[model samples]
Target: MLYHLAKNLIMILFYPLFRIKVTGKHHIPKEGPVIICTNHTSNLDPPVVGITASRTIYFMAKEELFEGKFFGRLLRKVHAFPVKRGLADRNALRSGLKFLKDGETLGLFPEGTRSKDGKPGQALPGVGFFALRSQAEVVPCVIISDYKLFRRTKVVYGKPMDVESFRKNKASAKEMSEGIMEEIRNLYEIHKN
Candidate 1:
C-alpha cells in the first residue's frame, strides 16, 4: 500500500546514495508476531531497516516528530506511531502490543535514543516488557553507519531470540532488558570484527 510505495521511493533515492548493505535478511521471520530490536544511530535507521526487511514494520517514533500536522499525517500513513521519550507512555506500549497481538511486526530501538558515538547503548525495559507480554520472538538488528551522505551503511539482522527462556526463568523486566542488550551488543561485535 502507501507504506510500500513510500518505502520503494525512499529505497530508490537512498540505496544509490548511501550504498546500503543489508545482511542476514533471511533471519527475519517470514510470518509471525515478532519484534525487530535494533540500534539507533540516525534518523535514517528506521527507513533503512524497514526497506531491508521483507515484511512491513510498524515503528515507534518519538513524540516530537508528530507535532506538525502534515508531517505527522505522513508518518501515520507510513506506519509510524508516536512514542513519548524518557517516560513509560502507556498508550504507546498498548499500541505496540496490539500490533504484535495482531501478528504484525513491531520495530524498536532498545537504546531508546540514537547513540552519539554510533555504539549500542543500554536498552530500556519497555522492549523486555513487550516481548514478555506478547510472547513474541525478538530479532536483533544492527545498523552500522557514519551517517555521511553518499557513504556506505550496513544493516545486519541476527537470529531471533525467544522470550520463552526469560519467561521460564521468571526474569524481571530489567533483567530481560539487560539480556536483550547483551545479545545486541554481541551481534554488533561479531559484525564489527
Candidate 2:
C-alpha cells in the first residue's frame, strides 16, 4: 500500500536528517477507534508523528497542501485529508468523525496550526467536539525538536485520556479541549529537554 511505502521511505529519509527518537509508543492502542492529539510546531510534525506511531494515522492536513494535482493525490493515497483552516469546515469534521467511528486511528493537531515558538498552544474546541461525539480514547503526543538538520527529534506518546466521563457529564467542547491540551503540555514539559 502507498501508506506503508511512503512511511518507510519517510523514515529512511527523516531518521538521518532528524535523528528521530521515540518513546511511550506503547501508549498507542494496538487496535480500536482512537484519537491522537499532538502539538503542532513544524510541517515535519505530521511525518515525524506518523513515523513514530505503531499504526497508521490519518491526518487532517491543510487545504492548501491538497491544491496541487499530483501532491494531492499522493496525500490522499497516504490517508491524509485536507481541511480548510480558519473556518468550521464541516466536511473535514465529518470525515474525521467517520474515520473514528469506523475504528480507525485519527491524528489531530488540537492547536489547529503550528506554534512558531515551539510551545503548546490552546487547543481548538473542534477536537473536543469530536472526542465527545465519537467517544474515542484521546492520546496526547508531543514532538520536541527545532527540526533542524542533524538535530535530534524526540516524539512521545502519552497515556490515553478517557473522555467518556466528560461526555456523560455533558462537558462543553471548550472544557474537553482544554483537558486535551493540558495533557499535551504536560508531556511536552516532561520530555522537552
Candidate 3:
C-alpha cells in the first residue's frame, strides 16, 4: 500500500516533467522471490528503476542517503532501504533476506555506488552472497539514460540469470562474484553503443 501510493505520488509529481520510457519489463518475473540487479549511474537510478517496474522494487540505498529526516522517511516509505556502503552491512543483508523469505522482490545495484561516468562499472560480489543465501533468481537490468534527461531513459530488463548452477561450481567467493559481474558486463556490452 505504501509502495503503490508512493509510486503513484512520485509519478504524478515527476512523469509530466521528464521524458520517461521503460522497456524490457516483460523480463521481470511475475511471482516469488527475485532480485533485480542493475547498474548504478545516477541518483536517479533507483527511483527510475523502481517507478518504471510495475511492482514495488525494494532497493538498497547507501546509509548516507538516508540521513535527512524528511526525505529519508519518504524514500523508505517507497521501499528504499539503507545499507552501509563499501561493505556488506549485516543488518541490511538480514533485512533483504527476510523480505525474500516473505516473497518480495529486491532491487540491488551490485556496483554498490554510482558510476563516475554514465558507463558500465565493475559490479561487486554482494550479489553473489544474496544469490547464495536467498537462492533467488537474479533479473538483470541496465537503465539507459544519457545522464542529462530522463526522457530517453530505457531500462533494459535482460534475461534472468540463474546462479544456482554456478553455486555448485565450487568456486571461491571472489570467483563467484566475478562470474556474476562478468554476466553483468556482458549485458552491459550487449546493450551499449
Show where candidate 2 strays beyond 4 Å.
none
Per-residue lDDT tens digits for candidate 3, residues 1-193, read 8888767787775565566666678888788888888888888787777787756678887888789999899878888888888776899999899988888899988777788887767767787778778867778888767656345566778777867777778665556566666766777687675
Model 3 per-residue lDDT at 91: 93
Alpha-carbon deviation at 166 in model 2, angstroms = 1.7
Worst 10 residues of 1 by lDDT: 184-193
- Against the reference, the lDDT scores of all candidates come to 0.89, 0.92, 0.76
What are the clashing pairs of model 1?
none
Name the runs in model 3 displaced over 4 angstroms. 12-18
Pitting candidate 1 against candidate 2, the one with the higher lDDT is 2
71-179 in candidate 1: lDDT tens per residue? Answer: 9999999999999998899999999999999999999988898899988998889888888899577899898888688888888998998678899999987788878
lDDT winner between candidates 1 and 3: 1
Flag regions of model 1 displaced more than 4 Å: none
TM-score to true structure, per model: 0.96, 0.96, 0.88
**Steric clash pairs (candidate 2):** none
